[model samples]
Structures are given as C-alpha cells and as structure tokens.
Target chain A: MSRKPIHRLPAWALRTNGAVVLLFLYAPIILLVIFSFSASRIPGQWGGFTAEWYATLFDDSRLQRTIAVSVRVALVSTLLATVLGTMSALALERFKFRGRRVFDALLYLPIIIPDVTMAVMMLMFFSQSFSLLESLFGIGLSKGFATIVVSHVAFNIAFVSVVVRARIAGMDATLEQAASDLYASRWQAFRFVTLPLIAPGVLGGALLAVTLSLDDVVVTQFVAGPGSTTLPVYVFSLIRKGVTPTINAVSVIMLVASLILVAGSVGLQRANASRGRQQLRTSGGNS
Target chain B: MAEAKRERTERRRGFLLALPSFAYMVLFFAIPLIIVLVYSFATRTSTGSTSLSDWNFDAYRKLGEPIVRNVVVRSVILALVTTVICLVVAYPFAWFCAHQRQTVRNVLLVAVMIPFWTNFLVRNYAWRILLSEGGPISSFTEAIGLGETDILFTKLAVVIGLVYAYLPFMILPLYASIDRLDRRLVEAGRDLYGSGPQTFRRVVLPLTMPGIIAGSILVFVPSMGAYVTPELLGGGKETLLGSYIVTQFLTARNWPVGASLSFVLMAVMLVSTVVYFRSGGKNL
Candidate 1:
C-alpha cells in the first residue's frame, strides 16, 4: 500500500509504458477471440459474425477424441503426481536424510530442463526399452497413451512437490508436535493436523499438474505414437497445416479451460492466506 | 537409547516417504537422460537405426560442422536478443507493479499470470494469426497509410513471439525483487546527493541482481531451446537449435546427432540453472 516513487521517470511516461506492455501482452489474444467468430474463412478477413466455428468443432470427432485423450492423461497423471509429489515435499521439508542435496537437485531437474531435451530423451528411452524387452522376452511396447501419462507424471511431480514443499515449509511444525504430545498417534497427527493445513497446496499442485498435462505439446509430440495425439499437439498439427476457424475455436476452448483452472488456484490461495491470518489472530488471543 | 531409536525411526520414515519420488525420477527421468548420453556415442547405421556397438565420437564431432555452427549461432543470438528485450521491457513495468497499491498489484500480477498459465501453443498460434499476411497488424499499418507489412514467418516475428511468451517469466521475478526493495535505502542515497539514475545504479541494481540473473536465465534457456515459436512464427525457413534437433530425429533420422545435441543443450541449461540458484534466485 506504500506508494513510494523511487525512480525518476515521469509518471506519465511510466503509466504509458505500462499500458503499452499490457496491450502487447493481450492484443493477440483479443484478436484471436474476436476473429474466431468471424464468418470469413480467411483469418483476418471479417465477414458477418457467426458461431459456425463452434458448430464445426462439435462435429470434428478427431478433435473430440484428442480432447478426451488429453483430459484422461491429465487426470490420471495429476492423481499420481499429487500423491508422489506431496510425499516428497513432506520428506524434503521435514526430514534430514543422507543425499538430501542430490535428491533435491534431481527433483528440480524435470522443471529446469528444456522441453525439447526431455522429449528426445523420452523418445530414446521408450524406444530402447521396447527393443530390450522384445529381444529378451519377445514382448514389445510402444509410445502412446501410457507413455504420455508417464511422461506427464514425471514432470508434474516436480511442480507439485515444489508447491507443496513451500506450503509445508511455511507451516508451523509445532502443531503436529503438540498433537503428538497430547498422546495422539503419528497418523492422527498427520491426518487431523497436517492434512488440513496443506490441502490448499495439494489442490493448487493438482491444478498445476492438470494444466501442464493439458497444455503440453513438445514432449507429447515426440512420445505420442499412433492414435495418441493430445489436444495441444493436435492443434499444433492443425496450425502447421494452416490456420483455420476450427483451430481458433479449439484454441479459445483450451485458453478458457486453463483460465478457469488458474482462477480457481488464485482464489484458493487467497482464501487460505486470509484464513491463516485469522487463525494466527485467534491463537494470539489464546496465548 | 530410546531417544536414539526414535530418531532412527523418524529418519527411516522420511526415507520411506521420499523413496517413491526418488525411484520414479530415476526410472523415468534419469534413466532416459542416461540413455540419451549413451546413444549420443553410438553408431548411426545407413538405414538410420542406431547400433549399440561401434561407438565413436562422430556425433560430438558433428558439432563443428558449418551448418550446425550457423544454427547454434543464430539460436544464441536470438535468445540473447529475447533476453535483453524482455529485461528492458519488464524492468520498468515490474517496478511500476511493485510500486502499486496492494489491490492494484494483485490485479497486475494476475494479468501477468493469465497469459503465463494459458496454453503455450495457443498463444503462439494467436500471434501467427496477428502477424499473418492479412492480419491485424498488417491491416492497421495499411489503414494508417504505412503500407502493408509482411512480418509473419520472419525472424522479427519469431523474436516477437519469443518475447511475448517469455516476458512474464522475466516480469514475475523482477516484481518480487523490486517489491522487496527497501525504499529507505533509496531515500538515503538521494539525501546523500545521489541522482535518480545514480541511486538506481548504485543501490537498487545491486539489490535486484539476483532477480535479473534469474529472469535472464529463465528467458534465455527456453529461447535457446525454443522449437514451437520458431517453427510457428519463423515458418521453418530458418533452423534454430530446437527445430534442428527435432529435424535430426524425425527427418534426418540421425539419432546420434539428435541425442548429442540434446545432451549439450541440457548441459547448458543445467549450468545456467546452477548459476541461477547460486545467484540467490529465491523468487522462482
């Protein structure tokens, strides 16, 4: 709330710069939304507005299938990632064990590595594994839905663990200790005390995991086998072919879905923060 | 003895809790990287299938090739430009955001996040629409009597897309650092006869150096490894490191080359990441 003017730039210049940058960030998105409804087949040309693109999208079974695949992959991967990541976060935050630094670095690797490298690495991994299996046991496997889900979980775990670890780190450890001192079992301490405190973080991590899984393209593109294309990868393919009203509609849908997810995350965090403050105030009064 | 036993039990519990994640990373993440490393040294067959035997440094030697060098140089330049542009554009905006009232700051931060969290491919596709031959920018220029501009599929368009995509990465960290700035220090510097720019250079700049380094690494690493933006906006005429690496795998069918390129890119990213954390990049 403190408005201290530290920089000497003219107020008008600073305000104008802010406006221009916001416009730069948003103009394309606005244009994309408006033009998706345009009746013209050409992207820029605007005929009378129509909802034909949305109608066409409904009829595109290929798009529908890809969307379904994406959702399934995201849901399954997010579930696995939430459990694994939350456990890892608790371990990292609360425990002192051997090789902690190396484990920490390993956890961050998926997030810091470039998408292209991860993609190619996954490609090599799945292919080589398949050949090894085939040569050894005459059983073969290929990249598809399972590979996509596995890769999604691999990266999503890192993100989930980071978010959860931050929450766990900020939480007061004495609450659980107090529970135990009162003769509560460890499971009771965790379940009754720790779980509620970290629920927002868990939900936030799950939302992030779902969003990343849905939005992935580079990794999915490489690992996706026959009939395994997700929505974003499918959209990328459509763009490569040429821009169309269908692509616009699909893009808008994807954007809206993620917008809702992000909004939910922000809302949850804000609510938890206020509740935390209220709890602190009440606890202070008791003290 | 009882205390020691309890401590050992806690340690065992912690290890048990962490074991699943560690195992998953090893199997899915680390092993794949090791496979890439091994393949980087394997022999490429005439039919493009990799042979496990007859290892050589042929793939690593390909790094000195003229074509590969040109792509690497181009990618490095483009990434540097993107990083510099993002910094120049984001610094003042982050300062402005950080200086705002609480409500206003939250709104601005949310505005930044909306785009950041949106689908990456869709956002780039939006730019493709905006910069297409008959798109909005072209239409606006002609309407303003500047004549039509063919900006799509050019390196300039690619730069625009890169900056657009990664600008928020730069902004968020800068905002966090600037918000943490002690305004009293600035006032002190000014009272000591420091000019606005002088105070900024001597005090504010050093304080936010971590954010600057972190933001630059965040933008530069992805820009260097960018495949989608260049392929989408650059129209595939120019081959950057990302597209080049992909081409080696899919089109050229040279797995060794692709693996080696990937290994080098990951190494560069890993080093930058180490530098980023070492520089006290706490915001990210």
Candidate 2:
C-alpha cells in the first residue's frame, strides 16, 4: 500500500513480542511432552528418552477403566446434545414465536455460567431431586454415569445450538420454501433440504460436545460417584496427589488427543467457510 | 379464519420442535439455579446437614465475615490483576495480528487458540511442572548463577497461570475489534497533523472500547471464580473464592453458606455478561 503510517509498529518489535507470547503459551506444554518420555521417575530429571511411561499407562487397569467411562459418557452426551441443539437451532432460525427471546436467553445461560458454579448447581439439584423422588415415589438415584451425561448435555446443548444456529443463519431460507412450494411436506423439506445443508454444523457441534465431555474435570468431580470417574477427573486427582512419570504420559496423551480434534474442527470449519464463499460467488445477489 | 388457523398451526409446530430442549433446560438449568437460591436461606445444622425449615439470613450475613471478605477481596484483586496483565500483553499482539496479511493473521489466530482447545487441567499441570522446584525455569536460573527460584505453589505462580490460561480470551475479541476498525479515521487524524499517540487516543481507543470491555469481562469473570488454577498453583495455603465455596459444600458440609456464595458469584458473572452482550460482544 502507501508508505507505512507513522504509528505502525516496527516489524522486529512485533515479531519479538509475538514470539515471546507464543513461547510463553507453548514451552510448558512442549516440556511436559518431552518429560513424558524421560527414563527417570523424577519429573525434572531427564535421564534419557524412553517409552516406559507409555508402556506403564497400558499396564494400569485403573487408567483403562476411566478411559472407558469417559468415552461412553462423551458418546452418549454428544449424541443427545447434537439432536437437542439442532432442533433448537431449527426452531429459532425458522420460526417467529412468542417467548422466543426468553428461550434464547435461557439457552445462553449454561454457556455463560462458570464451571464451578455449574458443578455445584448440578450437585445440589441431583441431591434434592433424588430425595424428592424417594419421598414421593420410592425411586432413588445419585450422581453417576447418568448424571454426568445429563450435566454434559446441559452445557453441550448451548454450544451445539450456537454452532448449528450459525450454519442455519447462513442458509437460504427460500430453498426450504421452494421445497414446500413443490408440494413437499414439512418433514420432507427438512429432511431433504435443510438437513443436508446443515450437516457440517451438526457434525462440528458433535465434535465439540465430545471434546468438552472428555476434557471436563470440575463438573465431573462434583457429580461423579465412586466407580464413575472419567479419565480427566482421574488425571486431575493424579496431579493433585503430586506429579509422577505416569501423569506426564497421561497429559501428553490428552494433549495429542485434543490437538487432533482441534485440527479436525478448524479444518472442517475452514472448508465449510470456503464452500459458503464458493456458493456466494456462483449465486451472486441471491440473498 | 383459514389464515388464522394456518398461523396457529405454524406456531404450535414451532413450539413443538423446540419443546424437548426447552423442557430440558428449564428442568436442569433454570430450576436448579432457583434451588440454589432457595438453599442459600436454609438452615445448616450443627451436624452439617442442611434443613429446609427455619430459614434465616445467617448465610447472607456470613458474607460480611472477615474470613469471607478476605477471600473475596483476594479473588477480586487477583482477577483484576490478571485482566490488566492479559490486556497489556494481548492488545499489542492483537494489533500485530490484525495488521498482518490475511493468511498470516489466520495462522496467528489459530496458534493462539490451540492452547484453548487443549485440556484445561493439563495446561495448569504443565505450569505446575514449569514453576516447580528444579523445573526448567528454575534450572535455567541456577545455570545463570541466579540460584534455583522457588516459584511454585505461590500466589505469583497462580497469577501467571491465570494470565496464561485466559490470554486467548482477551486477544480474540481485541483482534475482532481491531480488524473491523476503519483505517480511514486513523489516516484522517494523521492528516490533521495529530501525533501518533493522539490519533490512537482520540480515534483508535474510543472505537475499540467495546473490545476492551468485552475482553476484560471474559478474562475477569472466569478469573474471579477460578478453581483449577488456584487449586493447582496457589498450594491451598491461601483460599480463593472458588476453592472456599467448594470447601463449604464438600468439606465443611455447610450448604447454605456455600449456596449463598455461589449465588453471589453467579450474580456478578451474569451482570458482567449482560454488559458484555450489550457492548456487542456476541462474537463468542
């Protein structure tokens, strides 16, 4: 462009600051990964690179069980959240209804609320609800896999809906109208036209839900009963008990898992954005 | 009459489509929050059970207790300091990113967010490792003849962890505002012979005020109610609001007091979030 403005920052200064901040962000994680392979049991001492910690993880049955629980919970919760969130997104995007504003605000609550507070709320709610059920119908329950799934869906629904709603907002409503005008039933219109258009968003939301459910610790800690500890919760306890070589391995595994998922998510959204741009370019002034 | 009937059916169908999610949120989220508020007034017995009968303001009054006040003040101060540091660091970085070409900006933004997507607990654990005795930083200091620095389990470590954790929150919003800024105004200010600082102060700062407010709230709200950072880094020697509230419920078994503190924290977050939304911070 024209000669750089007087107020523009020097390139070297910007690069240095960016490098420092990035290093601050990444060094700890990179170090943790490196130490995970250390032959020494002591965390700070890097004896030699070995795969013993990774081997140790496989031998630990406790870790295996927790991973199983986390997977089951994440799968079930992500499914439920995707369905509920998609339905809510469709309702908000396609309709003009009374109390819509209220519905919108309520949907955002679970997201904006803090994690610890949400954990406490769910704890209190389950306890009180279980007691009430016992007193009234002799049915008793406690926090476990079911409660964890429920808590996860509560938050995931908001996140999923936000993602799906973005997709729905970008869509051409007239396509659905066209389908209906062609004598397609409402269900048929949604199934054929709307669903295919928003599939990427639905999948993206599900990916996010599963990741969140898997990574959750604070909320799960409060709601999980004995025998129901998820992997992250178990890892959290291990860290609290003090660092060990095994925790390093576990942390590295977790880091890699999330890294892959995030890369997938970013890739999916990028592809979707480019496709939207292509559509716009092909159908100029359609909006 | 037919038109009216058709509109009515559409409304009914719309409500029906959303019914399951609406019911779930009300039952699990809204009602539970109401229950938390109710529990705040319930009586806590000496035996540590919360009784519904004979509700009182004892729990609310305990909010004024010296111990509670200290924890609240500490949480506020720590949160405030974290927000300020995050802003100071993130603003320049965000500016740098916004000034970059599109491909570079996108790459930089994604790099910033990679930590955010990774496990939260694990990130804090990474810090625990870094700041611990004989950790890499300490070893480096020792190598430089500065002696081993014992920074772990201290409040300073807690602050560092907090800033590290929430820096992305500040940067993203600031970048959004900066990228959306009209460059012509800056040029106009310069053409009027305004100094660089004056152009920034008069035009840039005011235009990006929304981002500042949004980023501050995003960072501050979570920092105030932080549980994991303090638990991992603060060494439990000093109780912050989040850990203190957990203690009342899990350890102390004083539900009323815990519920009250939770309610107050929720109220503060809700207010700040409302301000954030009003300032057009819907990008989240």
Candidate 3:
C-alpha cells in the first residue's frame, strides 16, 4: 500500500474520479428503488409514494410462477453442481493424472465461451437429440424445467469447481495424511479431515452457483420452452412491453434479496478466513 | 507390490470421482461445440431450415455480405470503445481503492458488487429510464443550457448502456491487481533515480499488466456479444452482432447462417483468450 505518489495525477482528481464512478453505478439503482414505490403508472417518473406496486406484484400469478420456477432451478442446480464440482476439484487437486491439462481446459471452456454461443449450441444439441430419440422410440423430451436445469448445471459445475479447487489447493494436506497415519481409512481421512477444512469453500461455491443460476437470462431464454420462463426472462418481457412501476417493484425486491445474500456470503468468507488462519497457527504451533 | 497396488487403487478412485464432471462436460460442452461446427458448414434450405444432408461453405461466404459485415464491424468498434472507456475510468478508481484503508477498501469493493448482485436486466432497464427523453439527465442538460436532445435510441445511449453494464467487471479485477502491488519494486525503481512517472511507467504499470489485460478481456468479450443493452437502450434500431445473430434464428429462421456466425465469434474469442494466456496471464 506504500507505493510512491503518482504526481502526474493529483489526489483530489483521483478521489473525484472514484466518487463519480461509484455514483454512476449506484444512482440508477437508488432511482429504481425509489420509483418502485411510486404510485405512478409511468416507468421512471415519480408521482406519489405508495406500496401499490408491491401489492399488484403479489396478485400477478404469472410472475409468481416464474419466480417459483427460478427458485427451484436455482436450488436444485446449485446442489447438483456443488456435489459434482467438489468431486472434480478433489480429484484434480489431490491426485495427479494423465491428461490433466486437457481435462482442466475442457472444464474451463464453459467459463470462457460467451453465453449466446453456448445457448445456441445447447439448443441445437438438445433438439437434435430429441429428434433422434423420437425417430427411434417415439419419445420426446420437452425443453422445460429439465432443459433449464441441465443448461444451468453445465456452467455452474465449471464455476463451482473453480471455487472449490482453489479452496482444496489452499488447504493443508498434512492433516489428511496425519489422519491416515492414525489408522483412519481413506474415506475417513476425507470425511473427518478434508471435509471440515473445505466446507467454507463448498458453501461459498454453492452460494455463487445459486445466485448465478438465479441471475442467468441469456442461456435460459434459449433453452426455455413453453411455460418455462424464469423471473429474469419474465422481467425482460415486461421491459419489452414498456416497463411499469410494478416491474420496478419486482426489480427492487430482487435486488434487495440478492444484496442480503451478498452480505451473508462475504461475511461467511471473512469468518472462515480468520478461522482457517487460527487453525493453521494452532496446528503448526508444535513445529 | 502393496505400494504399487495402493497407487493403482488411488488412481482408480480419483478417476471415478472425476467421472461425473467429465461426463457432463463431454455431453453438454464438447458435443454442443462440435454441433455448432457441423451446423456452420451445413446448408440452409429454401424454407430457411438448416438441412444436415447438404454441406457447403455458403454460410461462411455469406458472412462477408455487407449487412452482416456492418453489424460485425459496429460490434467490434463499440466493444473496443467500451473497453477503453472502462479502462480509463476504472484504473484511477482501482488505484484509489487499492490505496484506501483496509476496511474502506472492502466497503468500496462490496459497494461495487452490490449493483452487480442486482439483476442485470433490471439494472439495464434503469439506464433506459435514466437516458430516456425528458428523464432526469435530459432535464439536467436543458437546465445547464445544453438543450433537451433525444439520446435514448442512439449509439451514444448504447455506449452508455455497455459501459454501465461492464464497468464493474473491469473495476474488480483491476483493484485486485493494484491492491497486490509490490511496494518494494516502486521504492527500488525510485532508488535507481527513476522519477515518479518513470517509476510508475516501469514498475507499477508492468506489475498491474495482468489486471489490465484481464479486465479488458472480461469487459470486451461480453460487450462484443452484447444483446440486451443495445436492444433496450438503442431501441433495437441499430443492428449489432448480438441482435443480428439472434435475428437469424428467431426472425429469419436461418439456422446455418446463425451457427456459422457463432463459430466465427467463438474462434475470435478462443484466439484472444489463448493469446492473453500465452502472453503471461498467470492469475487467470
């Protein structure tokens, strides 16, 4: 933090620039929250403060259904992604194998590719597979909840694996080795020693996966079939039809919920980090 | 013999553990990419359906037509501008964030992410309201004697949308690199009689090069594929690559052409990613 002063750029100028950027990011958000409570039917202009928009939102069954669908997809996909990703992370981190680089690249591919491309590709693949199945056995897979979940899990796994892998790599391996030395089996070594150490990473990764699945729009739009619209996609449709204050209410609620989650996730990580440091200090005290 | 057998068992177990993820990727990621490649070379039937039977270079050849070319060029130019603007705006802010006290730094980082945590579509919708005619911004401009001009349905509005959406992507990465800056190097460069600017140019800039490239790539790639911002802010009047590609599938029903354009976009992304990594992108 003690870098030499950047004399060419004065401190006041730098501070102002930072302030503007922060304002640029937050002003619209605050405005949206304010207008969400407005009694006006117009989108942005404030007429009178009221909670009528929130009341209207409760009566909108379509929005409610979409929200339910989104929550279900988020939770299920996160759970699946967490389990699969944690396994992959442990395998990659704990054991060296041939084709490790190729495997790593394949996993990272989902992250780097743009969502539009992935969306199109997944759509094509799914439709083609459906065609093949129907041709052979006259069975069809409707692209609804399953399609959304599958597409989400495909990317979420990669994301969760990356987070969990970082956690696993940073963990002390000697604890597990010492467990084995104490006559514990390999499974017991993993369960008792490694699992507790990596729980924070797992939880963090799950939080990320759930939020990402909830926030996704582009990929879900392509994969979602009849009656499969998620909340964000539904919001996009509302925007298309000229946004109202009710939609603003929706956005405000969504934003507030995620802010809470964000706060919780960051707090959890900070707590875990301090605990991990303390554990290291105590465990290494003898040495 | 026992040790060898144990090693074999461990390897077997490890592979078993990784099987689910590997299988999922093979089914979803790898196969879909292959499908895009195959469809890109397939034929577009007269009814606008992609026929798998006939294979030709028609789609690739069609990519150079004036309309598609215009959209492609426009997208590239807009993405480049957005990247540059993000870099200029984010660098000073990131530098400032890095220099702040630890608690303040964390608070600033959290604030940046708070907007990001909100739904992207909702946030972009906010920009639409902000930049619309007779909105606060328009009223402010009029009060300041700049005149009330329509800005929402124009390229400038689209640029505003792109920058707002991707600015955080740029800031977070840049802050990470700047915060981890090695002070000893700056002091060393100064001790060697390098002036402040020289030391900054030589030491600080090079140290944060990774962040610059990463932030640039993060902002640039997504902005290149931008769909919603332009559609919402630009009023869908102008065709960028994103809307153009979506149009092929939805409105035009030309799957082969859409698939081909997708491949080209994917190729550009892959090449740039590899170039970035090859050029010493370690933190990635």
All candidates' chain B TM-scores are: 0.97, 0.96, 0.96
DockQ of 1: 0.76
- Model 2 Cα displacement at B57 (Å)? 1.6
Q: Residue A125 lDDT in model 1?
A: 90
The residue pairs found clashing in candidate 3 are none
| Per-residue lDDT over B83-121 for candidate 3, one digit per residue giving the tens place of the 0 to 100 score | 999999999999999889988988899888877666788
Name the regions of candidate 3 deviating beyond 4 angstroms.
A1-4, A280-287
Which portions of model 1 miss their true places by more than 4 Å? A1-6
Separate DockQ for every predicted complex: 0.76, 0.70, 0.70
> Can you give the TM-score per candidate against the true fold?
0.97, 0.97, 0.96
Best-first order by lDDT = 1, 2, 3
Which portion of correct inter-chain contacts appears in model 1?
0.79
* lDDT digits (tens) for residues B95-176 of candidate 2: 9999899899889999998898888888998988888888888999999999999988888999999999999999998998
Between candidates 1 and 2, which one is better according to lDDT? 1
Clashing residue pairs, candidate 2?
none
lDDT score of model 2?
0.90
Measured by lDDT, the strongest candidate is 1
Q: Which ten residues in a row have the lowest lDDT in candidate 1 chain B?
A: B275-284
Model 1 quality (TM-score): 0.97
